[model samples]
Target: MKKKGNKPLLDMLQNIAEGLGETLSPFCEVVVHDLRNPKNAIHGIYNNLSGRHIGDPATELGLARIRDPEFPPRLSNYANTFPDGRKVKSTSIGIKDENGEYVAALCLNVDLTLFQSFQGAISQFTRIEDGRVHEDLERTPAERIHARIDEFAASRATTARSLNAADRKQLVQELKKEGLLEIRRGANIAATHMGVSRATVYGDAK
Candidate 1:
């Protein structure tokens, strides 16, 4: 049972949830559960990503809290997927009354479909292992070195000039893999174009 002053805290959290949902917009869903009544525990739902509304029954996590007195105060960054295969990253925070018993919970679910699409695109474009020869029969070593660097930056959705130290190191590794680093003065040309010293490239090569 909720204590006498529990209503005010729950109401405050509900208001905070409403503002959170509004600020995060289309990608985030926020749900508030009133554990006092598990059958219709949803005090409010915002963004509606899951298509659940107020008066909806408590979710599995909420029910677990009710059953286990020692349930964690917060559970965060867990994975959840919808019926449509939309992926969600979620966090649940349990709220307690003055008696230290769980009385409510605030849950946030963030849809990762957009991010997943970007990840897939990155994987497709960055792949260099097609088991085919890309070496130009007539191109000079300098031209091939520059071309490889440019390709590496493009695959990562960035420009070679804007590549950071870490990016340059990775590029050097890829260059070594493609046998460009074995060419005479290949390391010097790469260092010059990449705005890094020859030693930096060699250090990364190791």
Candidate 2:
């Protein structure tokens, strides 16, 4: 078995990190890990957080990929915490070669502290009536979806993940009533937050 670096693929990954970093800038950090070299797996990093540098050792996930050939390829948004106590949300994707070998990985970490602070500030400002009542204008579609999910989960006294089929249906109906499902790609977004599939979301929407 011959193992060699894939220049084209690496270049593409680098470009992807750079592009995403540019858009999210200071809030997002993108890192590329080369599985072939575990000791120095960090081949590239953009919008650096965690104060990590190129040639840094593999992360826990990177090491896991090295050990398990059947490791999941894609990891969706999940919570993380920095050493300095900053909260983060992360997603990771593993790249495989023709031989079904994990060759590289791309991970994105988004700092949530700034956004939390910003949300708090906005909440305070919104609370102060400016001579006119403005509708809930500060929250984005995703935020709204998350809020509704949280509210539903609270009502059931269970986590969103614990929502049964009936619970999900009711939650979906509530979301639809709030006009959340009417937004572009709203079903997909809501499904992701509700920990359900797009097909499930569609069924509930109907």
Candidate 3:
């Protein structure tokens, strides 16, 4: 009787594990690729260092001198799942064994998906009296300009099912006049977040 009860419990645990693994498979594959690329690079360097082929001894020794003590020797991955279900970012660690020593290093990347409902809710909360206010009240003049340009592009794209050339041009002019275009000139975050181009924002503004 006890064995029968435990069997069900074990089956439940296995099912849960399988479900979690299926959900995480894509992210895990990305993490594996990230780790593998750098590990291959390092291994190639090590092979050259060991005089497996032909290379300068001092150069190889110099490459070997880079070290950090806090990491580990086996590959490990860490990821964070956003509450909005729209973004996942992961870090991959590469482990190495060096002369009876273990060393590890990390590479990190972010994967983002937009959740319109979540964004709308947040934007709504930030608005005062049915009017939206700039989120970066403390930003520099240039930063504010860029932010506004990105915001305009994002707003236009989100609302328009199909924008004509004239409409796009108008949107660009409006963004530039509002000082949004200047801010985006130096930032990748604005482009990535808004899902538009630095070129589009700049060209339209111009």
Scored by TM-score, the top model is 2
Flag regions of model 1 displaced more than 4 Å.
1-4, 126-206
Give lDDT tens digits, candidate 3, residues 95-146. 3433332232222333334344567889988977646665655886555645
Question: Model 3, 24: alpha-carbon shift in Å?
Answer: 35
Per-model TM values vs. the true structure:
0.59, 0.60, 0.23
* C-alpha lDDT score of every prediction, in listed order: 0.88, 0.88, 0.41
Which digits, one per residue and each the tens of the lDDT, describe model 2 over residues 33-62?
Answer: 888888989989999988889998998988
Q: List the residue pairs that clash in candidate 3.
A: 73-95, 145-179, 145-180, 146-183, 146-184, 149-180
Q: Who is ahead in TM-score, 1 or 3?
A: 1
Clashing pairs in 1: none
The sequence of per-residue lDDT tens digits that candidate 1 reaches over residues 116-162 is: 89899999999896678877578889989988999888988887777
Q: Give the better candidate number (1 or 3) by lDDT.
A: 1
In model 3, state the lDDT of residue 167: 65
Q: On a 0 to 100 scale, what is the lDDT of residue 113 in model 2?
A: 94
